[model samples]
Target chain A: MLDSFYVAWRYLAFHKARTATLVACVTLLAALPLALQVLLEASERQLRARAEATPLLLGAKGSALDLVMNALYFADAMPAPISMAAQDQVDASALALPIPLYVRFQARGFPIVGTTLDYFDFRGLEIARGRPLAMLGEALVGAEVAARLGLTPGDGLLSSPETVFDLAGVYPLKLRVVGVLAPSRSPDDRAVFVDVKTAWVVEGLVHGHADLGRRADDSVIIEQTEGNTIASAKLAQYTEITEANIASFHFHGDPAGYPLNAVIVVAQDAKSGTLLRGRYLNGESPHQLVLPGAVIDGLLADVFRIKRVLDAVIGVVGLATLLALALVFTLSVRLRQREIHTLFRIGCSRFTIARLLGAEMAIIATASAGLCGAALTAVHASSDELVRRLFFG
Target chain B: MIRIEALEFSYPDASLKLRVKSFQIATGEKLALIGPSGSGKTTLLNLVAGILLPQRGRIQCQDVEVSSLGDRQRRDFRIRSIGFVFQDFQLIEYLHVLDNILHPYRITGALRLTPQVRERARTLAAQMGMGDKLHRPVDRLSHGEQQRVAICRALLPSPALVLADEATGNLDPCNKGLILDLLFASVADQGATLLAVTHDHDLLPRFDRVVDIAEGQSRS
Candidate 1:
């Protein structure tokens, strides 16, 4: 038996290309389904943990999935905007503590999250390198954003414009990066968080420009009427907020009427959360109150359903590949007929010939198994990052 | 060393048949069986090696009845007492020169491949002028060198009888003489009998006896 293996090893080693191709095919056939399962399990853990941590969500009457994805994950899809009065209503009900979110902009490729300081406490985020957000327009960058853009305390981050050609539309705001949050290993790691007022400034809802009362530059005036001076399109507006120009910035409309994307409601108790849900069930409310955990569970159900179909497809392909491998072995035996004849002429028994072929197959299978094991170990280690990038990107 | 009496055999898939009335080879004798193509020269060689069973005959090699032995017993007897050298050399392409020489030991448990056997193989390769190329693949060797390797493999077991089926037919005239000399020298050194089959008439004079295998080596 040992001599059989020795001869078999020589035969396989002599055919380098055929041996390598066989190993690669068998390894991939075994590793694909296993890697997919690892990633899906990781995705489930990631999606559910974030959702179950928050009790309820309040947003404009629309897709609860979209609202949860945006408010909790800061996803690119912006749900229909609700007014700030929704957050006020949640607060007035005395049932939950509502954290307002105005996530409607981007800085570079990362999402710019406009939220209150209460969100930091709710998510258990802490400053790692700089101070917290204390004043308007001061930005606290996430750990991943800071590392990717090489940002540190006292640096500046400019909000991205919605469009370069939106000349009369939203203006880009320059925010001061006062701190960098520690790595939370969640969606917050990839965000740039700021006070909601800074986001409104980026929206051109409230802005500050040159004072019209002092007509120091008459040439900039488009029209002057009784007791008021109208400015032209070239009026010098403050893009970066500083101590000198902070007082000049002001809001134009009622604070309750401002646009908000969603509100994360943390109820004081289970009864309060249930009552909040009951309020939205009345059918006359403009906003929808959702339990985020239930929304994620439904999403996972659909994912698992699709997973079943994928599993079936992979099974068929695997079976086909196994059949092809068997055919290859059969053809190889046929091709080696002359060699077999020589062995028989030299007095090799039938059982000995079969043992030689079996040894060759055992070596190939062992090599493929080793390669598959290494590949699975690598996928298992990186499943978390893979899920975050695949599902939430 | 070999005797056949009233042998009759035919392949199951083919209509070709072979018959031998009576034949005998003396111990330590070198005999050559000569015939045209399609004659039963190589079939007689296989019968003497116990690779094919006779339908109605008895073949005795060194007092052992090779014809009456079962399939497994014939295989065992053949490996223990007979060595074969083919015209094509039949060397496995994937193995190196030394590995090709030692292949017979690996195919059967009846041949115990020990350290002494390995050393003898190396010494035999050295004598064949292939010591420097022992690790070279057989496919990379010349026709003459490959035949030399086959001769080394057949003579390694020092069998009592060596079967050569057109061993020198594939070589050139110069290589033919040299290969026949090497084979004759090895058989003489081991005091073994040799039964070589060939169609080449020029090399018949070197054997001790010659038989024309028309219809068969032995006839009624």
Candidate 2:
């Protein structure tokens, strides 16, 4: 066998370009499916884990997929926002802990989420630096947001306006960066957090004033400050709220009508989750209660269906590559027929010829497999980033 | 130490038949085989080496019945006892000069490549003026150098018989004479028998006897 290997090594070495091309083809075929499977499995695990962590979600009667995506991933699904009254109702249920989520704004391409301190505690997010949301208009940035935006405590970010043309619908609010959360390795790390009321402020449901009628100097502020204070172009929007003016931040409209995109409910137990789902089961009700896990499972079922097709495609490609390898080896042997005959005349047996060809193939296959294994490991290691770019982006 | 009687061999799918009525060589005789292009000089050599079995004949080389051994046994006997120098000096192109010489030892267990054998191969290469070319790939060598490497390989195992089929065919006149000198000197020093096929008649006088295979006949 060793003698056969020595001869095999010589043949392959002499034909460097052919051997290299064959090995590269094998590596590509091996890595394609291995990388795909590793990334898909990692994304599935991440999605399932996030869904399982959030027990239930309450939202307007609409696409449950959209509601779950909005709540769990802050995906721009634009499911109709449920009223704050619904969130108050869940809070009053005493069956579960309610955390209101309102996400309709962006800052520097990152979603700005408006929720309460309970949101952080519920998600087990720890403040890596600075303090939590200490007051309205203050913000807590996720680790990735802080790192990517270079925002530290006391830094400020302006929300992206809903429309650059329609200044009446909502004015972009300026938020103070009060804290940065530790790495969560999830979608949460890519979001900005604030008290839900701050989101209302951005929506024109809330406002701040030294007074709308009088400027801080006690003079008529502007000529357009009569009908709607937030819509008034001359009604100076507070770009920065310091301690002196922070006390004046307050909501103008009926607070009960404020919008919440979805309410995440943490059940006291599985029984409480069942009872909550049961109470929201009235078919005529405009709200729907759902388990985030079931919703994600439905999403993954569709993904897995696509995966099956992908796997089949890979299987066919693998078979084709295997055929190509056999063809290459056959042609190689035919090309070396004269050499084979010479070996025979030199007293080498037929077994040695077979072993020579077999050893060359074994070496190429083993090396290709090793390269594929390394590629799979790299995909596994960077899968979190892949998921973010694929789904969240 | 070789004999052939009533030998009849023909290639598969060919009409030409090689029939040798009688032939014999002493244990250490240097015999030259001369013939035209279509003559069976190489065929006769192949038969003597047991590479091709005679359909109806008796070939005796030392103790082995060359015409009757099985396929595997014949191969073993060839590697252990007979060395062939092909007409084309068929050195494996992928191997270096040294490994080409050691190929028989690698391919079969009939001859163990002892350290002493390796040393002897180096000494033989040095004598053939190929000692410095041992590590060079055989394909990169000049025609004369390649022919010398082929002769070195044939003598590496110190076989009982050395068969040459136009062994010096690719060399110039000067290198041809030099190669012939090397071949004769090596065979004489090892006490090995030599049977060579040649188209060049100028060097025919060096052989102890010459066989003309015009119709597969002999004249000594």
Candidate 3:
């Protein structure tokens, strides 16, 4: 048997290109389904864990899936934003402790989650190093974000502007990284958490500029009306907030109408959760409250249906590839007929010849299996992040 | 020694028939059999080697009757007692020279490739002037060198009978004489009987005896 294997190895090694191509084909065939299974399993686990953690979501009447994805995963497509009044509504109901989330901005590809300290307590996020968000314009980054951006406590992260071509649009805010969250293995691990006021700052809703009252240059102040001074375009506005200018940053209009993508409501108990869901049921207001777990389950069902279609397509392709491989082996056998005849005439039995051929096939399959196994191991190792990227991208 | 009498053979749907009334080769004798195309010289060689079964014949190789043996027994006898050298050399192109020489040992469990057998194979290769070219692939070697490797493979088992079917038919005149010299010397050293089938009458003078075949019968 060892001799047979040696000869088989020699034959395969001699024809390196053919053997390599066959091995690559088989490895891809075997690894595709397995890698997909790993990623899907990870995505399911990730989606389910986060969804089950949050009791309910309050947002504008739209796709519940979109709301849940945006509110939970900080997905790229934002759901229709309800006012801060929605969070107020939930708070006023006395049924839940509403955790207002304004997840609408990004700082260098990481979502800037705007919420109060209650959001941190609800998500169980902890400071791994440095202090928590204590002052305005200060932000705490997730462990992954901190590591990826090479940021320490004092490092600065500039928010990515919404529209680069919009000249009057929001300027990129340079927020101070005050703290780094510990590794949570959740979407929070890659988020940039800040106060809801800072998110409004990134949206240009709130800002600070050089005080016209203290303007040393009178030429920049175009108008001086009662309790109001209209400034010219040359009046320097601060894109970054510091201790010197922090007091100047204030809202211009009613604070109740500030936009929030979704508010995560933590019910005081089961009855309170039910009461909150009932109050917002069927669009009682312009807002709708949803059971996030139910919404995620519905999304997973759709994902599984698509998975079934993908599985069927892969099955057909696998069958076709298998038939093609069979044809290749048959053709190879025919081409080697003369060699087979020579072996027989030299006193080798027909059974031995067949065994040699079988040995060759076994070697090829084993090599492909080894390569497939290695690829699956890598996918399994990185499946958590891969799932996050695929879902949240 | 090989003896054949009243031999008859034919393919199943073919009109070709091969018959050898009587033929004999003594031990250590270099006998050459000459015949025209379709005259059944190759078929006669196959019949003597027990590769083809004769319908009616007494084919004795050494102490055993080659024709009466079972299929498996004939194969064993052929591997153990007889060595074949073909016109085309028949060396596997992928195998290097030493591996081609020892390929017979690898293909069958009957022959154990012991360390001593390996040493003897090396020595045989050295005698064939292929000691330094043992690692060279058979496809890279010249035609004469390939035949030398084939002859080395044939003599590796130290068989009692060496059968050559137009062994030097593919070589140039200079290589033909050189290969013949080496083959005859190796057979003499092994004390093995040589039954070579050839169409080259020029090389017949070197054989101890020559037999001519016409149609299906032998004429010595």
Candidate 4:
């Protein structure tokens, strides 16, 4: 048998071009769907794990998909302002810890999440370089953001466009990169973190009037500076957070009257989460409470149904590839009739002839499988960037 | 000993029928079948080798009936008891010369190529003037050298019978004589029977016996 294998190998190597082309065809056909499956599975696992970690999400009335994407995945647009009254309702509930999240800005295409230090502790993020965001306008960059943007402590970054390109809107705010988070293999690796107050400041919620220069007279004469003029001008334009001025950095209303996008609520356990969900759905409550995991699971269930269909399609494609391989081998044997006859004349039995042919095919298949496996591992190693390009784009 | 009694065969698509009656050779005898093209010389050799069984009669080598054995048993019989040489010198093109010589033993699972067997192959190859061509692929050899290798392969196992189908049909005069002498010498050294099919009248006198197979009949 080993001798037959050697013979088969020699024959294949003698026809290097044909063998290589067949192996490459087989490898590509096997590798593409395998890689796609791995990526989808990895994304699903990441999303579900992140969702399960956060027990509940309290947000203004909107798409639950958007809410989960924002609070859990740090994606999509921030929800409408749930009133401070609504937040107070959830904060008063003894069953949960409300972590207010205000997201509106982007730094070099990464979402800027404004929340308290509890957000870091809850997400298990650690500062890998420099200090955490302790002051307004200070930011903690995710590991990927830091590495990609080459940002370190004290480096400054201006907020990117909130909309596609709202040039007429307020100028981008300059934020100081105060820290970089340690490498965490989660959604935190793609976000920029700051204090919720900084988010409000970035959004122009609370206005500050700095005395640019004091006049020499005892009675001070004040000229509205560029900073105040820009702030107040923006504040007067927005009657509400409409599509026109929702991304506006200036707010004309009282700063205390402003609303947050959503509040991430962590229940003590599964029982408390159920109790909170029931209370919010009682119709007496002003705002709605949702379990991030359950809502995301519902959303993913639809996606998984599509995935099953895709899997069936891939399964059919794989079977077709196998059939094509069998056809190639069968045709190859037919084409090599003279060669087979020659082998038989040289005292090779019919069984040896068949063994030689089988050994040749097995070697090619095994080699192609090995190459496909290595290619998958390389894709897995670089899946982070691939996923970001696919989902976060 | 090899014997074919009242053998009648035909190609699957042809109406031509081949008939051979009372063809026999004693053990260790070298006999050649001489005939023209379409005279059924090659077909008779194939039948005797159990590669193609006679449709109407029996081919007996030593004591085993070639047509009575099943497919697997026939394969074993061919590997253990008989060897073949073709006119085209049908050596496996991808194998080296030495591997081609050992091809018979691979099928039989018989570890026959001991030191003595290797020495015998080397000596026979040297006698046939192919000692330096052992590692060369068969396709690279000249027609005469390939025929010598085929002959060596046929005799490598020291089988009870060796059958050649126009084995030296393409060789030059000098190489042809050398090949015939080496083939008969190797069979004599092994005390094995030889049944050679040929159309060359010049080579007929060297064989122990000569039989003319025409229209499928063997006439001495």
Chain A of candidate 2 gets a TM-score of 0.87
Tens digit of per-residue lDDT, candidate 4, span A1-393: 777777788778877898998898788888888888888777777778888888788887768777777777777646667755566666687887788887777878888888889889888889999997666667899998998999999888777756657656544667778899999888788888887766766666643432224323423333456555332232333222223333433446665556677888888777887888888886755567887788868867887787889878888887887898789889989988987876565446677788888899889889899999999999898786776566554
User: What CAPRI grade goes to candidate 3?
Assistant: high
lDDT of 2 by residue, B1-220 (tens): 9988898888787766888888888889999999888678888888888888888889999877888999999998888788888868888999999998888888877788789888988998999999898899988998888888888888888889999999888889998898899899999998999999999899898889888888555555
Off by over 4 Å in 2: A76-78, A105-110, A143-180, A199-241, A248-255, A269-272, A278-284, B12-14, B114-118, B172-174, B215-220
The interface RMSD value for candidate 4 stands at 2.5
Q: Between which residue pairs do clashes occur in model 2?
A: none
lDDT of 1 by residue, B20-130 (tens): 889899999999998878778888899999988878999999999998898988998888889899999999998999999999999999899999999999998898888
Error of 2 at A154 (Å): 5.8
Error of 1 at A167 (Å): 3.7
- Best-matching candidate per lDDT: 3
Docking class of 4: acceptable
Model 1 residue A342 lDDT score? 93
Q: List pairs with backbone clashes in candidate 3.
A: none
Question: Between prediction 1 and prediction 3, which has the larger TM-score?
Answer: 3
DockQ of each: 0.82, 0.67, 0.80, 0.34
Per-residue accuracy of model 2 over A333-354 as CA lDDT, tens digit each: 9988988888888788898878
Residue B99 in candidate 3 has what lDDT?
93
Cα displacement (Å) at residue A323, model 1: 1.6
